[model samples]
Structures are given as structure tokens and as C-alpha cells.
Target: MKSDMSDTNNHGKEISDDAFATLIRNQFQLESLGERLQKIENETATMKDKWRRGDEAMRDFTVITITPTEFTLGTE
Candidate 1:
């Protein structure tokens, strides 16, 4: 129901040929960005699935719980 972006062009008044061309170009740009965002979302979902599987495996084993701030990873 709510609009995400606002359209600036006036529908009643006559628009110049150059303005029409600009509008078409902007619409294509938005389409390209939408495609890119969808691709990223798919990749992120894949990564999350992998992490969830790994966490489940780790939970089946015994682990030594420690303080968050006190545990320094990759450092002896």
C-alpha cells in the first residue's frame, strides 16, 4: 500500500523529448539495481544455511563455555 520511491514528473503537463529519454534511462538503472540486490540476497541465504548446519553439528558435541570478552580467538 505504501510507496517506496516518489515520482517527480508531472503527468498533466507536456514533457520535452529529452526529459522522456531521461526517464527511460532512470527506469533501466533501477531495474539493474533490483537484479543485483536479488543476487546478493540469494548468496546470503546460502551462507546462512551453511552456518546453521555447522552450528547444529557443533551443538551435538561437548563444548567448554567461556566468557565472551575473555576468549581471544586465534591467539595463544
Candidate 2:
């Protein structure tokens, strides 16, 4: 959620009438919006998978042992 890049400024760019109209039209189209939403959902699912795998790896490396006297920490 945090980005290292600064905000971008579109000061020097030029857009033709057709291109601008197409951009505006796409914003209002249901099909285009649905496709975009689907893409975002897929990306989110992929990130969650990666996080799950990382957690599993960390658990695999961690070992916690408990006894009557004290607790011990180790890696396997």
C-alpha cells in the first residue's frame, strides 16, 4: 500500500480528441470496468497466495519447545 515513487505530473503530454473521447468512453463502459475489476481480483489472489507461502516457510523454519522449567527457541 505504500509507494516509493512520487506523484507523476502530466504537464507535457498531448492527447488528441479521438484518444481523449475513447478514454472517457472506456471509463463509463460496463464491460471495460468489469474486465479491470477481474484483473485486480486476480492480482489480489496471487498476492495472498505468496503471503501464505511465506508464512508456511517461516513456520517450517521455527521450532518452539516447552518444558517444566523453561521454554526454548530454535530453527529446524
Cα RMSD, each candidate? 10.2, 13.5
Q: Tell me the whole-model lDDT of each prediction, alpha carbons only.
A: 0.74, 0.67
Give the worst 10-residue stretch by lDDT in candidate 1.
1-10
For 1-76, candidate 2 gives per-residue lDDT tens digits of 2222222243545566676567557766978889999999999999999999999878765534345346445733
Task: Report the error of model 2 at residue 45, Å.
Answer: 0.6
List runs of model 2 lying over 4 Å from the truth: 1-28, 64-76
Deviation in Å, model 2, residue 34 alpha carbon: 0.3
Residues 1-51, model 1: lDDT tens digits: 222223554635556667667777999999999999999999999999999
In model 2, pairs of residues that clash are none
lDDT of 1 at 5: 27
Among these predictions, the greatest lDDT belongs to 1
